[model samples]
Target chain A: MSEPVVATDMRKLAATQLFALIGFTVREARNKWTLLALFTLTTLFLFALATLVSIDVVEGSIASARLFGTIPLEIGNTTIPVSDAVTVIQVAIVSLLTTFGLVLALFVTGNIVPLTLQTGWVDLLASQPLGRTVLIIGRALGAVAVVAVTFAYLFGGSWSVLTWKTGFGNAGFLVAGMIILFTFLCCYSGMVLVGVLTRNSPISIIAGVGTWFMGLILYPLHTYAEWTTAFDPGWKRSLASGIAETLYWVLPKSLELTENATRATKGDALAWTPFLASMPFAIVCIALACWWFSRQDY
Target chain B: MNVIETRDLAKTFGGALGSKVEALRGVDLQVGAGEAFGLLGPNGAGKTTLVKILLGLVGASDGDATLLGHRAGTPISRLEVGYMPERRHYPGFLTAGQVLDLFGKLLGMDATLRRQRIDLVLEEVEMSSWRNQKVGGFSKGMQQRLALAQALLPDPRVLFLDEPTEGIDPLGRVSIRGILRRNLEQGKTLFVNSHMLGEVELLCDRVAILVKGKIRREGPLSSLRAPNPEYRLTIAGSDEDAARAALAAAGQEAESVPAPPGLTVWRLEVGDRSELNNVLDATRSAGLEIEEVQRVRASLEEVFVQTINEADDDKAGAGGPGGVQTSAKGATEVSVATREVDNV
Candidate 1:
């Protein structure tokens, strides 16, 4: 029993040190008014969703719906089935929420790394017993934790409202949210790396957005080039295709991750290759960030 | 064992594009346990850089440094060390207590220990009343006090403070000095980097003056400002001629200079204390009564200025771009010897 108590105490101490970064990040975000705004937006969005839609179910199916009881909605009109309509709505909701959530998380949390690198603060932290690598990784995890809490609140509220109105809810939406989070994690790793290297917030955000956009463009182009047997097999075409393929493999697969989340929501067969490939890419970016920060003189 | 030690520690910055700046040129330094050691220098003298290296905030370009017998930049080296940076700012959002708690956690203090230390340190710094106040609303002096509190929260074996009293009021500085004295009494070694000569003189057992990344002079504060082998004597106005003649007759060079009111003053340079006594005997035998005897001693500030100027002169004498290299080489050898003697 004594040994168990000592072990518990040691674990507690380790956790406190490891998660100290989360406390710091949350404190800074509160100071900057970022957390307050995020909470307020989540509340307002929930309120709107709760008030603006009305739904009815008949014979174990969503029978009728109205937009604020004014505009009538219909599904399964002759050729299209109600299940298809549900799939469409789920995909739309996931895409919009994931995309907007990523942007919001990036813009709000972008300054965390640069702020930690500020002269007086960084010096004090570096003087602690904490390793530089732990500091960097802890900070990154802290940012992720903040985003996770915010995403859970937003997505949970949306799920509750939609399930109550339509009598149709899927637990896979939560998994979809996790995938969105993983996608943001990938991009945020780049932001963390850039911020550590430059100690500039705006530049880090721009680099993050640029990385996301490169993935959005390159993944689709790579697919198109691979599938396009219609085009003549010219050297120029082949070179372009090769460059696109290389970029798609090198950069994070933001679009592909989102698509996986959508397919999971639809209960379709999922291809996790892109998701697995991107995980290593994100790890490398964070590792490089820690390396750069460890080598630098504060 | 020395609480802090560095041998041939050198750091250079910004040589990538053809303009190299050497921040520290092979500095050799040692501070014994439970000693208050001062590091003094002008701007760009590498005082802050040296502190940074010792605290493991920065890696040295070359050489070795250790704290509490562990190599610098290792986790173990900093585990028992605390540092208060110049112009330090805690996270503005945190309350003073929260900031201390966070730092305590980073130092791997358990919750119970952290709470006890937070209370003790806050009281030590006279900040117990402001424990819950947001750091953003704090004045520079208050922030400095809080910085001190955090540095002490770990109950560190060694403390490195850079201009700890820079923005504090006079009363605040006195209080801070008192706290530092108390820490020293508790047997904690202190390494202070500052340009405040008076404070250093009052606090440090020994000090080193660094100029252009090289230590120009270093030793006990008392020895750094040794009295000049010269004396000033005052005599009756009527005895001035006799005093001068007696001194010259004794084969000692003497000059009668202007005196205030009705007294005469004679300035004489002597080879030693025995020579000074001989001059007094000669004056007494000539019936020229000596009113007062004065020996001039330099102040720490004066020594600091003179040492910096002498280093500048040496740099100038060596000539051109290579002058810094020559000066650095000579100073490194001297610093090493000083450390060796100090260890003995």
Candidate 2:
């Protein structure tokens, strides 16, 4: 029973404990098959990009693309200009990364909070000298970090591969990766809030996907899908339109974010409305989750 | 100073449809520094709730709980507290050493110090050999030892163990008992929550018997296991008539236990100490030699059962709920306090 004197400061102590919690979350993330599968896919894509795929370049433009050294799909000889096709490829990559990262992250992390708060685990962590808010935030940030690293690997490696072979690259895809991460962050906050409230993983994921759906269906009808004409002209339609518009303002502007991402690929002036509106939703979710986690007992 | 204290502490858990469970109702208790305290109770007796409050796992609905002079659940209060939960679960992927290192970091230990302490605690719990092995593959006993090792990693001033011996073998129990006894010797406090009366009787300097969320009995082991008011004696000679006439002179009678031809053994119910001296005088006056005198004592198990029955509103015969009936929670029939070794 020897007592050791280290004279550690409070800030250092808090930081150390936060790091410890994050480290544990990472360890737990490694155990989850969802993360593992995502990691494996990202690695495989990187391998194929670096090894199997090749592009023939002509005057700083992608002319032909070959997959596993197959007969080149002719783009250099067709009417399609190489630059527009590369822009399409870049946006397609951004969409692929965003859609896959969002769905997989939202699905897997639905239960992450509840799982961390399970009986034995919660009992152990709660008894530690760290605050409740620190515990929750650390785990969430850890999951975010895990996703960030994985997405960065996929996005960065693909950009490098495409640039090496075809002399075509968009740094905007890297920025788009950030946007994807932010989008996932917004969804993650809601997921955590729901999981904390209900302590049910399934319900948490449903609320998360439901939020994404609402953001999609509740966007300005005419601006996104031109759906206002489909409804018969009446007070009922007005009421629906009014409610959907109100809800859309409060919800994440997901579809608009997709458009902004496309704008990013073109190196064009991007709309800030979607990014600005989506931020507050994330802030509110995180604030509410932190408050609830602090007050509630495990 | 008291390292742990609760004053009129109360906790009520909300149940379904507006129902409530009063887990702890006005429990007042204290444990001084460097003391081995045992909180013993049957299942659903609020032992878990009380411990949870002290550890800051749950909020108390009423009253106050303080740890190390800070409000329970505050960061400062748990600075020097070490807790071993009833259910042992560490990240299955982490090695034993890694688990200790992580928990050590939680205590804000530096890498140099954490490494030093982890190695030391691993040796202390005899898990040094398994330091690099994943705990997921360890047996329950090994995991139990590793759990203890983590609790000891910080060298906490107060150690709280819930069923430390649950999955350990008898020899491992002995090993843990020795480790805890040494901790007490080093002027550290040990608070144990267990249903095993024998464990408490062996390890605790003081015990509180909790029943149905109320403390029915609280005191030292010596006072709770009050000795029975009877004595057994082996006399050198066996002459029933001579012994009876001498006993009648002192107004005392003895129940003779048949013995060997050379010795006379009898059991006597003595009203007081002076009466026991008178019986000895009477036996000597009858020219009989006294070989041995023994006093039978009530076991702690018996005390626990009787206290529980008394707390059930004097249902001394009816037994309490959940069949806290006269089974002594699976204990030996009688306990001889003098024979058991005192490790603390």
Q: Give the best candidate by lDDT.
A: 1
lDDT of 1 at B339: 12
**Model 2: fnat (fraction of native contacts):** 0.60
The top-ranked prediction according to DockQ is: 2
Clashing pairs in 2: none
For residues B223-312, what per-residue lDDT tens digits would candidate 2 score against the true structure?
787644667777777677777677678787678888888787777778777888988898898887888787756677878777776776
Each prediction's TM-score against the native?
0.89, 0.88
lDDT of 1 by residue, B178-218 (tens): 99999999888889998777778778999998877877789
The C-alpha stretches of model 1 lying farther than 4 A from their native spots are A1-15, A66-89, A164-167, A226-239, B227-229, B249-251, B255-257, B268-273, B316-344
The residue-by-residue lDDT of candidate 1 on A192-268, one tens digit each, is 99999999999999988877878888787877656545556788667767777877897889888888889877877
Candidate 1 has a TM-score of 0.89
The numbered model that scores best in TM-score is 1
